[model samples]
Target: MSLNPLRLASKALIALFCLSVLTGSVRPTQLEVVRMQGEITMVTRNSPTTFYEDRSGPTGYELELAQAFADHLGVQLRVVVADSLSDIFRLIDTQPGVFAAASLTRTPQRERLVRFAEPYQQISEYVIYRRGGLKPATPADLLQGRLMVTAASSHSERLHDWQASNVPELSWSESPELEVADLLQMVAQGSLDFTLVDSNEYRMLQAYYPTLDIAFNAADQRDIAWAFGWSRDDSLHQAANDFFAHIKPQPLLANLAERYYGHLDKLDYVGARRFLRQADQKLDTYRPHFVDAAGEHGFDWRLLAAMGYQESHWNPRARSFTGVRGLMMLTLNTAKELGVKNRLDPVQSIHGGSLYLSRLRDRLSDVPEPDRTWLALAAYNVGFGHLTDARKITAQMGGNPDLWLDVKEALPLLSQKRYYRHTRHGYARGQEPVDYVQNIRRYYDVLVWNDEQTQPLKGEELLASSAITVVPPLL
Candidate 1:
């Protein structure tokens, strides 16, 4: 009864084998899947928006949705991270109780093959091209060739519809082996003149690949929904529908969307490009200091490094016009409180900053993480007092004070005299902290991506520890 996933899966396999022989049929029904496997075997492709590996294991928008559905079914979530759209559909087609939550657009062709749950989100398809390149003015212009898209994608359907009459010569190659990110990269490099991507995918990747511009809208807005095997019995389909009905109007959807795409628009093409370049140039110099501080404070060294970049762009000698100085950009009073004597010392600055952040995080012991860590970052920028006032406002406005998503919405109201006048900490510039936390999160994501793809740099190698501790940094 208290078995782990491996044991449960093993028992499920054995039970399924027995059932196949007993029923004299190998094909499992929805009820059979639920009875045999103690988990929801959901199918999806690996992408930023669909499903992908991270430090915490597999995570993404669709994965979260699938996990919720599994919980609703009172079972575990077993994600099948497929390589292509076709593979995703195939799993749903062949496996009982299997479903695809890869942010699939509910197209007519797909609707004919599999049943779709109630639509959850809507998206539009667009033809994308490199900025300043030969942009396609219409389907005919695109028909000249150099078009690429993922095989069996909604984009291909749009192309087929166009080629049927509008541009009978229109042709686009589908790379069954490649993902949307790969195709977008090709368009960015000018290897392909055109490709189609959903708006959500573009929003998630725009910060990273800013040069890829939208050429034209290729299709009308479409609904995204989960896919189940087409069957006369609608048990799983009905269950999925009930799950959607419950979450569609709740804060969960908004919060989840914010978690992934909230900071996407924070950085522009030039800003992101600049950050990546300096991530190599200036960050390496102060990398050791941040690493030492991070080791002592128990934080991701890159997170600390990203904070340093955000604070002062890793410039040890950099001074803000507001009298904040050095790599960590600490004020004299705050630096003194953190036992930082020389605010300009790069190593001391990072250590002081880390300690100050730790102290702020410590004060928020009652708050749950991620929000707790984010609130600490906000407090670090403005003041803890102002953050409290904003939290109070969040509660007064019927928003959850403990959730960063809700608190952030209330934060900007601090600038209004009508709102901040009654609070103890009055008229604080709240937007600064929002930008601060979001930017660092973006930078940290980039750093993590780089580390996963390449090797991570350990600050211990560049500089020996003088006296720092090994406490994990604040979240």
Candidate 2:
């Protein structure tokens, strides 16, 4: 009954082959494998809106949104940083094997190659100029020619469109290496006569450089959205649409808009003049407080001085109708919370304010860094509950909860019930914090510059102080 050796060997090989086929049948297909794992690969650019570093850590609008999306999908997010817009496109087109979304501009040209998610925000283009420079009223005025912009930007696209349609003879060189902030800096320094920027960016920059003016608006608006690779995965596309559909613009966004842009139009000439003169005289007296408080809280002393200026104009006896009193303007509750018995005591007031700010910052540990700082500033002015509501509104509006820009936009919405009741903090006057932060930032910058200008020339040798150290006013 036994078979020959060769025949038996052939039978064994066939059985082994059959067993292999049985095992292979249970393995998953590529699509099923990816779906089961649920990991999303997102591509983003390194910029203030997309991603950047601050005193805290990684932050930006796109970064927060990407993280949110990953959380929604119940997976880990892998962000691939692209060096340029062109690089982002190339990565999406060629590495279709990996990336799920590219937070990019929703342009006709881009739409032709990739599918775009619903528009999350709209960006208006504008021309930036120095306060006393020749302001261009129209595209034709630009033909007189002193304008520059970053290369490969939406601003460049708008400028090109302007040239092709209205000002055919206008010409300018592109500074490819310059970011929008750098371009604004060039305009501020009068190195460049004009530059183009998204209106939101223009507002933020203007808060810092009040002397910079918007010469004119561009002819068109750019809708910004997430770009997805051309795929048959209609489910992912539909999910994105659903998320955006539920997202509504809230008052917080409005407050942020006002915080950054509103006061720019109202220059506060008298208050500014008073602040300038007083700051020059008293900055030294409070210098030690800044040094001490900044050391304990890990903040710039100049920033502390700036905050004091914004809060109480550095007046030891400053008092607000709202019951905020002292040089740092601590409310009765805030002063009590920080263990300060006298709100008017300069040392206690500064220490209490710094402690309060530090606590606000710690409350937002879930938020990313620069944003954490920005949100803390908002909380410092408006209170923590209001800030939390703004973050919620930011999320509800399809914006990043961890981004200052997004939260800023959401803050003002607290005044409206249609949006505020859904928040934990109920209702608040969100605009105050936006204005408070912007003013402090402006005052701080001027103070820093003033300090640097006077440091060496007065023959006063200042030591290289640690993160904290206050100096007496020389003048």
Candidate 3:
């Protein structure tokens, strides 16, 4: 009954051929190939809204989502940087086992070329122009100015659709060499008339480019999702949909959005201009002190400087109504506890404040970072007791006490007598802490951007010293 080895091999090959004829082609599923390779390759573009280098090596809103999806599949994530939006799609078209997660807006044209996973976020397109420039009130007005968008982008597609259908006069050019951020900068510099950008991107960059303003919303809200190369196998696409479904009810997506965008709207044009002015005129004088304190305490010097600015606007002689004084705005008791003989001395105040913040973070050892750092900041503004009371209130409600977003909600409730009367620390201006933390975060972001722009020639190691971080260094 046993067959010869050569005959058995021939029989097996014939069976495989018959199966292939029936199924068209037999190949490993995309998910199976990824698992077998032990890694998934993702293509992304370099932008603040997508993937970019920071102190933590590489991170961004889109990168975070990609990493989560990779983890969901039980594989490692490998990122390949594409030079342009066109290049991103080209890589997808040519490569195997690769996907795009560059905050791509799903479009009809794109849907024909690739498969987009479930949409994770929605954003509207806006026509951006410099302040004091000719503002376009409608699509017709865009014809008057030089409007341009990135090549192969959703913005360009929208413009094309508009031009072909209703506004035949509405014409725009595509920039093969520039990105949305570059166009934004050009508009800010008065070199470009107008450009199209997403609402979220506009919000994130508005503080940095104070001169930029929205002319009008150009398109309706669109779905943003991950894109897979066109293939017969929808295995990976279904897996990505499953991953999104699993995280839909989780805090990861919300928290990531909050981390990247929550504080963006805090600084308006006037506030942004003032911060830039002071940073130019006064930051140089205290820069060394901040750096020294940061080195001693292992904090980003920009964070300390931002905190200092928020506290007293970087004035050494500044004093509050509550008797807090100096650049870092320390109370008399806090200054004494930190061994500062002269509360008005900028060096002493800066060091004392840094130490106090580190200690406050230490007290929050149980809380997970970013929330821990934000909560410590709130504690720095209000008090540890009030922060604990806020946490208690957050827990009493159906909110996650560990999340800053939820805790921030409960924080304002402390101001109301109805809620404060039951807490251990009654009657605190909870709204102040929320504003305090947000202002500091905004300042920190601007400072980071300023540093990066000024030191573009510096290598990554030097640049990383000015990068942002959510985690506090251990004492």
Candidate 4:
């Protein structure tokens, strides 16, 4: 077949144009995909599972995992915190171009919208009830009355599905302002009959609210995974899969899990509330002592105040069952070591406490900054030997020894001979220090915020003139 030259040339050009379009759409190779050149944006929630600010800085299970993943890829990790799960999904759905990973759960509905990596962790939903409430043994029992669940949560979805099929009469109310913790609180206080929560969250909360009972576990378990935008970019997907494959074997990942989920105790709300109220009153009187101590020790006064409130509610006459006494609760040995004649003297107590805490911090100089501070606080409550024992246990259990979260898990094990038998500090009250440090951190934050709200600015003329260097005696 013979064709004219012009027609042949036109057909050839068309074929070439089609080929160029195909080539342009082709995905880049893993090696050629700008290796270690771009920032890896990881989207996560502010919940404990994802990211949150602690005394040290930003931390959480997902936060650490994402950071480690970024390091493995040789890219700087930029975390994007979302206020809610819906917001996270919206961001991933709309701005597919921005994020590299979304630390979220893998569900059938979400799978249709985004690609998910291999499962990282397994989680289940549960019904939390007050200690004396009727326990719901099954779905049938839950249908007997009104129930509460977080808005737009997997709990709601599961309940909705169950109602539609198994229990036609089942109905539930939703709380928009409440988190799982709040729901658990309501249940614990007997305000609500029941509420649903994630099983992992329930475990963590159980440590604080030990009396709260789990009515039942959800019928199915949810697998949590990292999500990516729906695209044919198999290279990126393949890279993610490869990265996750390495994560499980790494001691750091296990450590991250233990840090956030392990070493939790059920909190006595009645006792905690009473303690908090008394601490509030005492904070006003001890404010000056904290300021002086902060100056003497080169630490944040608010932090010292927080520590005191946590230790003894800032009560100068406070005494613990373990023989820790005074405003900052100095033990006899610690007071003697700090050259304090009397632990009951508020000024001496504060100064001694600051000195002891500073020494603990200084002793851990090799540890990273924020972690060093956390370990010091833990040691201040427990003892250095016990803290070291916990760290060793954390390392042995495939956790990061340098991380406070991991060490916190190990702290509790110090009370258990199964793990602590080999430690230099044999049989210590590991749980006390964990609770002590956490409560102190929470109280310290509250006091700092409250002080900021009431006190005048540092440089204000009246404030400066009225601010006596020495705290006046309480009237």
Best by lDDT: 3
lDDT tens per residue, model 4, 385-450: 888888888888988788887787788888887877798879998988878877665555445434
| Residue 302 displacement in candidate 3 (angstroms) | 0.5
Candidate 1 has an lDDT of 0.82
Clashes of each: 9, 14, 0, 11
List runs of model 3 lying over 4 Å from the truth.
1-26, 455-475
Model 1 lDDT per residue over 364-467, tens place: 98998768888998999999999999999999999998888998998999999999998998998888899999998888877776666554223232113222
Candidate 1 vs candidate 2: which has greater lDDT?
A: 1
Please provide TM-scores, in order, for all candidate models, with all chains considered together: 0.87, 0.64, 0.89, 0.69
Q: Give the range where candidate 3 is weakest over 10 consecutive residues by summed lDDT.
A: 466-475
Against the hidden true structure, what lDDT does model 3 obtain? Answer: 0.86
Better of 2 and 3 by TM-score: 3
For model 2, residues 109-191, the per-residue Cα lDDT tens digits are 66787777787667777887788787888877876546777655666666666667766666775644455666676666666
List where candidate 1 sits over 4 angstroms from the true fold: 1-37, 455-475
Q: What is each predicted model's overall lDDT from 0 to 1?
A: 0.82, 0.69, 0.86, 0.71
Clashes of 2: 14
* Candidate 3 lDDT, 23-95, residue by residue in tens: 8986789889999999999999988899888664788998988999999999999999898888889898888
Candidate 4, superposed: residue stretches over 4 Å from native: 1-25, 29-37, 54-58, 97-103, 130-137, 143-148, 173-193, 203-213, 266-288, 291-315, 318-324, 331-333, 336-341, 377-475
User: Where's the lowest-lDDT run of ten residues in candidate 4?
Assistant: 466-475
Angstrom error at residue 133, model 2: 0.9
